[model samples]
Target: MKVHFIAIGGSAMHNLAIALHKKGFEVTGSDDVLFEPSASRLGKYGILPAQTGWLPEKITPQLDAVILGMHARVDNPELLKAQELGIKIYSYPDYIYEQSKDKNRVVIGGSHGKTTITSMILHALQQAGKNFDYLVGAQLEGFDTMVKLTQEAPVIIIEGDEYLASPIDRRPKFHIYKADVGVISGIAWDHINVFPTFDNYIDQFRIFAETIQPGGELIYSETDEVLKTMVDGLSVDVNKLPYSLPEYTIYNGITSVLYSGKSYPLQIFGQHNLLNMEAARLVCQNLGIGQADFYTYLQTFKGAARRLEVVGKNDNATIFKDFAHSPSKLTATIQAVKSQFPNRPLIACIELHTFSSLNKEFLDEYAGTMDAADEAIVFIDRKTFGQKKIEPYPAEVVKNAFANERLLFFNEPALLLNHLEQLNIANSNLLMMSSGNFGGINLIELKNILL
Candidate 1:
């Protein structure tokens, strides 16, 4: 098959393109611009575009299909050309479903923890030598790409995101997967620009739950009241399996899970991760992985990239970075680090990089979220406002929105770093959280200073 991608430089799109190329399909793609990792990975596979920018002439009818990306606008020239020629177009998830409809699809869904849960399942499956394909949000240690599609794998594990599929397809991506085994870790309102309202945002998950394949199993977090009430109230034909936080102990900064009277020590620790581990264990059970084997493989499951990932650590101090900016994620991450090591002084700093995180209305959602941190700091790079085309607000506005008088705010990277340098870091843990680069602040370099 011959596939051409429009706006192929996207994080998900590039991975799918590479997967198809590896699957023996003749793949070609175009993008307005490309960046590191995506650009270099595509170039290595001999699929990078000759030049940046759309070329409508490349969208000939000879192409078997055009995979559209959310990065491309509806009026994109290549898209218009494909439409004019009557060539079939597919959002990546739509095509992925078309390819995997015959296989067992296990989709992990939630506002948070889906990536970690999906990564855990993949790690276990890989260790057990199970034949499976997967699509996880973050890069894993053993995985080369975020997406994998194959003709022989009997099952496909998907991290089902509730975001728009493409510029033309407004339907949440999860609604298209029609999961045979669905997992909802939890739900917290996010994507302020997309949903506009909390109720509207949650309605997407409701729709997702209703779409699970008939007779399939739904493994959800029973601890999450919203999910528990929603899943139980539904009258779907699938088996409703509920899971909560498992029995675990944190000793000397190491966590161990007690199951069947046996203790399984783990390399990762956190309340949310323990919950995610339970969700993953249930999914692996559905896939025929025995109970003992599940815990055995889980011991080696470190975690996904940027999800409480350690950047630097020493005997006394630890420096971590995470991709957490939403209200619930920020709260959970801060609380997790604090609860794990109650004795250690934690300096939790976050950068409001996303449009939702910086929006005035959404800022209020984060009230008291970071109170668990011994010292809470917020950073919003002044230039980020102009780059995102959003109006800038003062540091006082942020401090007031968080409703914490002790919160320190910074609009400059130097000031933030300088503040870190001033803190007494003997036996302290520093957690720097953001979805962006913290305004080009080199965190590893900062880790050097703190540790």
Candidate 2:
């Protein structure tokens, strides 16, 4: 089969193209801009466009299918051409569903901890020597591609993001999967730009729950009261499994899960992660994996990239990074590190990067989120506001919104880096959180200095 990709430079789009190419499909893709990893990887596969930018010629009817990325616009030349030719077009999630329609689909969905839970199941499955098609959000250690497609793999584990499927398709991506097994890690009002109100944001999860195939299973975190209420009165045909933090204790900075008073050491830590593990364990059980085997293999799971990832560390200090921009995520991450190293000073730094997080109204949601840290710092670029065509917010505005009188804010990268450099690293742990680079700060270089 042959497939053409429109706007293939996206992280997920390029990865899907690579997966299809590896599966022996003819893959051709075009994008106006292509960056490092995606560009290099596509070039290695000899599928990189000889020249970048959309080409009408590439969308001919001869192509078997056209997969559209969320980055592409409705007016994109190639997409318009494909539409003119009546070519079959599929959104990334739409195509994923098409590929796995015959197989059992396991979707991991929620506002928080979905990636970690999904990664955990993938790790466990890989370790148990199981062959399964999968699509996860992060670049995992053992998996080469974020997406893998195979005809023989009987099951597919998907990280079901609740974001819009495509420019033309407004439906949430997870809702399109129609999962045979579904998991809701937790509920938090996020993506305010799209959903606008808290109720609207929550309604998406409710829809996702209702979309589970008949007789399918839904595994959810009981810790989130909002989520609890959402799944409370679901139809009787759909099975519901609620999970919580398994009894575990941290000793000398190591977290171990306790089963029948026997402790099993874990490579990962934090109560949130432990809770995510419980959700993952339940999903694995549905996939025919036993409880003992799941725990046995999960002990070696390091975690997904940028989910409280330890980038650098030393005897006196450690530097970690995470993809946490939302209020719930920020609070959970800060609390996790503080609990993990109670004696050490915790420096919590975050960047107001996304459209919702940068909005003046959304700033107050962060109140008390960084309170657990010895020092709390927020960085945002005034230039970002200019680029986004939004009103510029002063440092004091952000400081006031957070309601932390001691909170420090920076509008420039250099100033932020300078402030961090001046702090004494003794007996401290640095937790950097953002979905964007902190105004182009080189984390690896920063880690070198801290370590």
Candidate 3:
């Protein structure tokens, strides 16, 4: 098969392009701009475009398919050419769904926890020597790519994102999969720029649940009241499985899962992660894995990248960085770090980088989100407001929105770094949470300072 990708510089798009190349398909791709990792990786595979801009010549009648990335604009030149030639242009998710239509699709969806739950299931399956294709959002330690496609894998595990499928196709990505087995981790309003309203945001998940193949299983987190209600309203024909946080105890900053009067050590922790584990366990069981086998294999699992990732640690201090900008994610991450290190004073700093997080109205949703931390710090760049064309928020406004008297806010990364450096690291934990790098703050340098 000869395939070309529009906007191939995207994280998922580039990975999919590489996956297709490895599958022996004649792969070609184009993009307006390419960033570091994507450019380097694509170059390593000898597929990076010689020039950085899109070329209409890349899209031809001879092309078998053109996979469109969500980053591609509707008026993209290559896309326009493909449409003119009447070529089959599949959105990234659309292409994935088309490829796995005949297979049993296990889609892990929700506003959060999808990546972790999907990673957990994938790790377990790999450990059990089970062969399956998968598409997870974050790069797992043992996984070669975020996406894997094969003609022979009977089941395809998808980390179903609620974001739009493509520029032209505005439907949520998960809805495209038409899952045979579905999981909703939890629902919290996010991506305000896309959904606009909370009701509209939630309706997407409803569509996901209703779209599941008949007699298919729906595994979800019971701890989430919103998810529980949504699942309760689903048709009785759909198999419903609810999960909660597994039994566990934290001792001296290490969390262990308690099962059958025995405490099994775990590489991951947190109530949210514990809940994620239960959902993963149920899904794996549905996929023919027993409870004992799942637990046995999970012991060796570390975690997905940037999801409560430990960057540096010493005898008295540990620092973590997490991809947590949404309100629920921010709360869960802080709570996780604090739960694991109850005795340590946690200094949790989160960057307001995403469009949703930068909105004035959405700021109130973070009220008390950082209450779990011993010292909560928030960072937002003034330049971000300029780039986003949103009104600049004063630290007072942020502090008021959070409703935390002790919460400190910084508009500058250097000042934030200075404040953090002044902190006494003895018996203290630092957690930097953001979907971005906080104006390109060097975490490795920060870790070096801590050490």
Candidate 4:
């Protein structure tokens, strides 16, 4: 098959392009810009565009398919040419659903935990010698690409995201999958730019749950009250299997799940992570993997990239980096780090980088979310507000929104780094949480200076 991708430098789009190229398809792609990793990977595969901008000439009628990425605008020139040529053009996930329509899909969806749950399932399936294809969000250690497609795989595990499929197709990506066995970790309002209201954000998951194949199962977190309430009202025909926090214990900072007269030690920790493990366990069970085998395979699974990732560690100090700008994610990450090392002090710093996190209206949701941390710090680049066109608010206003008296705010990265450098993390744990790089603050340099 001859395929061309418009805006292929996207995280998901680039991975899919690579997967298809390795599958023996004739792959070509173009993008307006190419950043680190994506540009390097595409170039390594000899598929990176020779030029930077889109060209109508690349949209030839001979092309079998044009995969559209979210980064592509609706009026993209290549997209226009493809429409004129009457070639099949699809949103990335739409193309994925098209390819896997014949296979039973395990689509995991939620505001958070989807990537971890999907990673857990993929790891376990690989360990069991199960033949399966997968499309995950983050890069896993054992996987070559975030997406894997094969003609022979009977099942395709997907980390279903609730974000828009593309600029042209405003429908949520998961809505296109039409999952055979779906998973919803829980809902916490995110992507406020696309989903303007909390109700609007939640309704996307409702549509996801209702769209599952009639006989398939919808595994979800029963412990999330908001999610449970929503799931209870749904009238879908599929089996609605709800999961809760499993029996587990944390001893010496190691977490384990108890089942069938034995405890299975886990490399990962946290109540939220345990809940995610339960969700993964349920999905594996529905796929015919026994409970004992699931835990056994999960023992080796480290974690998804940037999800409570251990960046630096030593005898007295441990530093973690996590993608946790959202309120629930930030709270969960901080609680995880703090709870895991109860005896040690925790200094948790959060970067307000995303549109939602930078918005004044949404800042209120972060109230008391950082209470578990012994020292709470927030960093926001002063330039971000101007770029986002949001008026700069006083630090006191942010402090008031968080309702934390001891909270410290930094509008500059250097000042934040200076503050952190002065603090002795000798017997403490440091967690850096953000969806961004904390305004170009280097974690490696920070780790070197502190640890």
Candidate 5:
């Protein structure tokens, strides 16, 4: 098969391109601008474009299909050429569905826990010696690529994202999967730039429920009231399985799950992760894996990358970097770190980097979300405001929006780092949370300084 990717230097797009290349397909891609990891990885695979910009001439009739990335504009030259040639075009998610249509698709969806749930399922399936293909968002410990497609695998585990599929296809990525078994971990309003309204954002999940194949099942988090309410109103014929945080105990900063007269220690902690584990377990059960087998495999699961990952630690201090930019994710991550090390003071720092996080209207949603930390800090790069074409908010506005009297906000990275360096972190835990880099702050350097 021959496949060409437009704007292929994206995180997911590059991974998909590599997966296809490894699958014995002739892969070619073009991107106007390629970043560090993607550029290097693609070069290693020998699939990197000769030049950086799109060449419409590369879109030929001989091409089997064009995989479009969200990074590409609607008027992208290569895309226009492909359309002119009457060639089939597939969005990243659409192409994934095309490959997995014949297989039992287990899609892990929701605003927050999709990556963790998908990673958990992959870990358990690998441990059970199950042959399966998977597409997880984050890089896992054992996985080389975020996407895999093979003809022999009977099932495909997909970390279903609710974001728009492509520039042309505005539908959420998960909507195209038509999952055989789906899991909604939780629903919080996000992607305000795309969905615009909270109700509009939620309707996407409702559509996802309706997209499940006949006789399929939906595993949901019962603890999330909004998700539970949505599940209750689901008119789909598929069976609904609800899961919550399992029985667990934390001892000396380690968490363990008690099940079936056995105690299984977990490398991952936090109520949110436990809920994710339960959802993954139910999905595994539906896939024919027993409860015992699931627990046994889950013990070795460290966690998905950047989802509360411990980057550095010492006897008295630990530093964690998490991909938590939204309100709910920030709250959960902060609370998790605080709960795990109750004796240690917590310094929670978050970057308001996302479009929603930077928007003045959405700022109020973060109120009290960082209350678990002894010290709460918010960082928003002033340059980001200009890049996003949004008005820069005052530090006082952010402080007021969070409603935390002790909250400190910084529009400059140096000042933020200075404040952090001046802190007495000697018996404290530092949790740095953001979907973006903390304004080019090297986490490793920060960790070394704190530790």
Candidate 6:
């Protein structure tokens, strides 16, 4: 197969390119600019474009298919050329669906925890020596590529993102998957620029559940009231399975699950993670994995990258970095750390990076999200407002929105780092949360200093 990729430097796009290349397809890709990892990895596979930027000549009639990335604009030169030539174009998710149509598809969808849950399923499948294709969102510990495809694997695990599939494809990525087994961890309104309202954002998941293949299973978080209501309203013929946080106990920062009269320790913690584990368990059970085997394999799962990842630790302190920009994610992460280390002073820092998190309208959703922390700090780079074409709001607005008297807001990274350095780190835990770097702060250096 001959395939051309526009905006190929994207995290998911590049992985897809590599996956197709490994499957013996002729993959060619271009991007206006290629960053570190993507650039090197693409070059390693000998598919990196000789020059940056879209070249109309690269889009030709000879190509069998064109895969578009969300990074590509609607008027992207190559995309226009492909359209002009009447070449078939597909969003990444659409193409993924086409590739996995014959296989049993398992899609994990929600505003949060999808990546972690998808990673858990993949990890257990690998541990149990199951052959399967997968398309998870993050770089996992044992997986070579985020996208994998093979003729032999009868199943495909997908991390179902609610984001738009491509610039031209307005459907949520999950809607295109038509999963045989679907899992919704929870629903919290996000992507304000797209959906605009909480109800509208939730309707996407409702549609996702409706899209599942007939007689398939829908596993969801029973503890999420919003999700529970949605599930109750569904009129589909698919079987419904609801899961909640399993019985677990935390002792001296270690969490263990009590199941079948046995205690199984986990490398990951928190009610959110425990809930994620249950969702993965149900999905795997549908895929023919036994309960005992799932728990046994889950013991070594260290979690997906940037989802409560431990960056540095020592006898005095432990530093964690999480990709948590949404209001619900922020609250869950803060509560998890505080619950685990109840005796330690918790210093939780978060960067207002994503469009939703930085928007003035969405700020109120974060009310008391960080209240569990002994000290809460919110950082917003002044330049991000200009980049996002948003009028910057005063720090006081952020303070009032959070409704926390102890919340500290910073517009400067250096000052935030300075304050962090001055803090008494002994017997304390630092949780850094952001979808983007804290104004390019050197977290590893800070972690070393704090430790």
TM-score of each model, paired residue for residue: 0.98, 0.98, 0.98, 0.98, 0.99, 0.99
Model 4 bad stretches (over 4 Å): none
**Candidate 3 wrongly placed segments (more than 4 Å):** none
lDDT of 3 by residue, 224-322 (tens): 898888788776458898888787888876788888777778989899898999999999999999887788899999999999999999898999999
Error of 4 at 199 (Å): 1.7
Model 6 TM? 0.99
Worst lDDT 10-window in candidate 1: 417-426
On a 0 to 100 scale, what is the lDDT of residue 437 in model 4? 86
lDDT by residue for model 5 over 384-428, one digit each (tens)? Answer: 999999998787899899999899889998998888777777899
Deviation in angstroms for 38 in model 6? 1.1
lDDT of 6 at 206: 99
What tens digits encode model 6's per-residue C-alpha lDDT throughout 1-451?
9999999999999999999999999999999999978999899999998999899999999999999999999999999999999999999999999999999999999999999999999999999899999999899998888999998899999999999999999999999999999999999999999999999999999999999999999999999999999999999989999998888899978999988998899999999999999999999999889988899899999999999999998887889999999999999999998888889999999999999988898999999898888999999999999999999988899999999878899998898889988878789999999998999899899877777
When sorted by lDDT, best at the front, the candidate numbers are: 6, 5, 4, 1, 3, 2
- Reference-based lDDT, each prediction: 0.91, 0.90, 0.90, 0.92, 0.92, 0.94
**Better model by TM-score, 2 or 6?**
6
- lDDT digits (tens) for residues 1-451 of candidate 4: 9999999999999999999999899999889999989999999998988989998899898999999999889899999999999999899999999889999999999999989999999999999999999999899999888999999999999999998898889999999999999999989999998899999898999999999999999899998888999999999999999988889888988888999988999889999999998889898898889999999999999999999899999998899999889999988988898888999999999999989989899999999999999999999999898988999998998899999989999999889888988888999999999888888888998889998
RMSD of each: 1.1, 1.0, 1.2, 1.1, 0.9, 0.8
How big is the positional error of residue 112 in model 6, measured in Å on the Cα after superposition? 0.8
Clashes of each: 0, 0, 0, 0, 0, 0
Where is the poorest 10-residue window by lDDT in model 2?
229-238
Q: After superposition, how far is residue 434 of candidate 1 from its true place, in Å?
A: 0.7
